[model samples]
Target: MTGDNERPAYERGTGFLLARLGSLTARSWTAFLTEHRLTQAQYTVLVALQQHGPVGQRRLAELVAMDARNIVPVLDSLAAGCLIERRPDDTDRRRRTITLTGGGNALLAAVADAAAVEQDQFLHALNATERARLNHLLRRLYDSHIPEAPQPG
Candidate 1:
């Protein structure tokens, strides 16, 4: 393929749209999270815990797309607030599993409600059907790109 002014297929289609949408969605979500005294990183961790329950620190870091080293300070602050607890893993003495405390559960519930409002605010320009369509398309786009892990036999 030889062209001076031609662009790749994705540059003009789904990829470009997804990049723009992701930036807009993240910005809106971060602002909402800040109002609740949570950073985007903290909110991501909380959401993962709420969805996955107790998990090892390494696994949590992977789920939230954060470096393992950066997770410690956030965990420390949450632990100090009684929002999360760290306990020794039964099978691995050197590892600790983090779980949300009752307070953390309550706070996440409230934050989730606020997040719903924030989502509505972000999508206010679109009609209900358009919003639903956009969400469906976005999910499909992500699902197509994310590589699937092989299952152990």
Candidate 2:
């Protein structure tokens, strides 16, 4: 990877750097979340439910960026662990909503704190202002390119 060290700066494109960054972040998150026996996708579902309240499975899938088919197993794992509950939507019989249980909230809080440590370590080279700016730029790009996920009614 450092072969570019001798090459001109222009030779290494931003896309290549971005892909490397993505892999670095994923590995860091995987290590951190492993301690909690949670995958990043599972933690994502918990955090979304903790923040957004109960939501239909389809909406939860959208929120977590998981495919509609795959979210089920994550939900099942969480449900089996008693971290979440799947309740029938009162107004919509065909739909079910997922809610974080008290245990889930507690677990989420702990996991979030641990996750923050990983984030800090990963961005340690950046000063506060630069970190904020980088986050802002990423969010802007994501928001502009990705449509908002539909929310459960």
Candidate 3:
């Protein structure tokens, strides 16, 4: 029980605050990606490929923190757009190595500027130092919970 000056129980929860922030950011990201004819999953895969180089489908899925089962449709959509290539592995014919296409690289470069702008707008309240601290804290939390997950560069 609390006075009228006190925040509600839900407002005091870190999870609730994080979820609210996540929803708002996700909507902005989704809208931005939709304009580029891409989804979050597709963007994530492209970034992973850019960072890690050509990798097999299962490894790509793992790198993106996505289930192997769910990655197929995302890859299919990217393949349809010719944004990515899936080639048979040299050593293992059964394994398909996924690579970001030249087109994907171009698209990522084009959108990188816009993404930075949007991110700046979203965190306009924070100064550069504060933003860095926030990111560091978030990364620590992520590493603690998902130790196996690769840290995004």
Residue 65 in candidate 1, Cα distance off native in Å = 2.7
For residues 56-144, write the lDDT of model 1, one tens digit per residue. 99989988878999999999988888888999998998999999999989999999788788788878889999999988987897789
lDDT of 2 by residue, 6-82 (tens): 87776478877788799888887788888899988888899889888998999888888889999999999999999
State TM-scores per candidate. Answer: 0.76, 0.79, 0.81
By TM-score, the better pick of 2 and 3 is 3
* 1 versus 2: better lDDT goes to: 2
**Can you tell me which runs of candidate 1 are displaced by over 4 Å?**
1-22, 148-153
What is the C-alpha local distance difference test score of candidate 2? 0.88
Top of the candidates by TM-score? 3
Which sections of candidate 3 miss by over 4 Å? 1-15, 150-153
